[model samples]
Target: MEIDSKDGIERKLNMAQQSDFNDPVISEHNIYVCHVPVNSAFYRVIFPTSKINPYTNKWLKARFKKAVRMLEMRLPQDADSASFDAKKAKYIASQQQSTSKTSFVMDRLLAYEDIFIGQSHSFDAAFEYAISNIYLCPMMGSFEMRHLQAGLQNLQCDEAIHADTDSEFTESESETDDDPSPLRVRFVRPENEFQKKRREESVTLRNKVAEHSSWISLDLEKSTMKSASAKLNSLFSLPNPVDSLLKLRDAEHLVEETIVGNKLAELNLEDRHSLISFKEVRRLPDALQLKALFIKVGVISMQHIEELISFKIEHNLLISRIREYAHLVRGVWVIKSELAFPEDEYSLQRIVRDFALCLLNANLPVRRSDMQLAFGLTVEDFDFSLTTFGEHITSGERTWRLRIDGDETFGKTKEDLRVLIEEKRYWNRRWEEIHHYLSTIKNKSDFTVQKTFKRSFSY
Candidate 1:
């Protein structure tokens, strides 16, 4: 048997050094940027293997010098080997307790053990010290929560490191498996009651979201026709014959005559009593008067009629509004009519205001479905078309925000809004004036008809 010599071991060490440069082991020892939230102050570095000893005594000298450098500022150079070994072991053992809950302390300890081995000059001794002295504290949180907290902590560490480079080693500088940051720093906080509750709620919400997002065949089939129909309605449309024949005076007047006669016949004593109970009996003639007036105006579109109904319902005057509705139903069917599509200007403005309120309340860009839910509405229930809404609201990745610039709140205020408000008021006043004129003409017609009937019946 031949005894391994110093020269042989030195040659092997040199060859290993050269081989390491070209080996794939460099990739396995990946440099990871670590963060610990426990301390919220520092990051630690982690090494791969802790084997610093060689087969011969010649390797001992080089190993000792490097060990001295690692522990140089903390320990004296003249410190005895045994004392240095004890201190190094204690340091690493203390570090293990500081690691994140999901982080493997043993792997990190093994990497640091190599440096400690240089001081102890014994692989077995350092390995034994590491295993016996390093303590891994029990984690009190769920594994995923621990991991998520650790990841957030790491990001904070990364940001802190960038702001100040005093702990530059913590940031990843190489592609090696060795963690570039300090592994001894505590990156995570212990779970408290508040945090536990929050995590539980978060988990529950996530599960609910997952369930909601799942594709159920029934739901898909149910929505399929509705979505198709909506698309079809938007893509194709037919003009109402009522709108086209509004220019023919005799045809339109005949239709109005039939509506008024039917409404007068439907107004039974019981219906009139019900209207009186609601304090709306007085508005019955106004409804008839408005309908006759609208027929004569010719320019008053069917959408304007629908708006009148909506306006009456909104003001709790539905009993009065239904009189006008009665006439509209007859005219639409007799003329084979569909109401013309209304301009979205006012409706779109209202919807956009709702979106702005949503953002203000949430303080973040919310999903469209979430906004709709807040309003107790389905996605399809928005007053304006989605295509029109898209023009005003700023859309994000699956989210939407209000374009608040030059608005009264949420962004810079400007004079343009006031001008817009004035324009709206001006149009409203003009519309009121036209309605008043129509009402005056209808009152005169009713008086003339009553007087002519009285004269014809004189005996």
Candidate 2:
């Protein structure tokens, strides 16, 4: 696979990682690989390194293809747009009915949940974060739990409550002054049955807190569960009510912390294991990416579709997370509406290319070397200069320059100097559409471009 030194995308790759500026004259052999650092919180939570199959990797790449199609379906042609299509919506709904990954989702969530509740390990990814977190509440991250537990430990406060001093806030108008009075009012105990019952519950709650504190902590290796429980019972006695209440509250806080901590820890552990299962991914055309590129795209059979789903599961955490929680998680991530990607080998190849280019639009500029490493260019007739359109526009009420890359780049001259000088955004929506088109082409077989990339441009 070789990309010509004149390719703009390749040029961008050359200068991006190696230099501080855009060095436009690309050399044939100067290829570059773009690596997005995984240390960021988003990447850490979103997509971590995983052992994925190469074939399945292609399906993950289909998300890019889907990105293109989603744009195409909603927007006007080549104008960077999207729209509502009731018919298309119905078609997507039909596809969702056929593609269900619920079993896999359930399996992964429970495994992770078990680990999370155990209170160990950090998380690299979270499949169903909201649901998982909500489910573990009262066990973790429950402010109410923390508050109640902390309150129970204040045995001195409880004794004070028994001592007949309580405060209330009241706003009153003073007879002698025009200004209202805002002061805390201290009141003596009423000595009523209601107050006595309230006082009793508070004491009981404090006791329960101590009983559960460190329930799972310690001595597992030193003693059996029965022995540990016996020891805990003996250790739990207090000299008086105050000491008892305080211990109970401390124990409650500890229990609350431990439970939540364990659950969070387990989620991280499972997510890490899932990443371990991810394989090296390559982009493939998915049904959604397909429908966006062309209406009458090539035929994709059920077998290939399965392969695509596998690719998505392995390389794409977004897809994997969905599949991991299929039991509770539904609705395609808007990118999985793959119903029309070309299924032919030649078309799949192009689809792969288009998908990669679509990623470029996302600031993930791929080099020709990447193309070779990924999927080689199949369209030998691709003339870079002719496939784009360059122009300027006013954005944010300010005059700006813009250049758009079209599909065919036919009969195009050199980069338009006027468009280049005036436009800040020079790429075209067609590039996204076309990039998806190229990816669709690559999904069929192992074909690649022969031109090498130059290292003098920025995407």
Shift in Å, residue 451, candidate 2? 76
Q: Please give the lDDT score for candidate 1.
A: 0.34
- Could you give candidate 2's per-residue lDDT for residues 64-137 as a string of tens digits? 01111110001011111232232323333333353435586443322211000111123323222342221111
Clash tally for model 1: 20
CA lDDT of each candidate? 0.34, 0.30
Highest lDDT: give the candidate number.
1
Candidate 1 C-alpha lDDT tens digits along 365-425: 5455654643444556443322222223444456543222222231122443343344345
Question: Which stretches of model 1 miss by more than 4 angstroms?
Answer: 1-249, 260-367, 373-376, 380-459
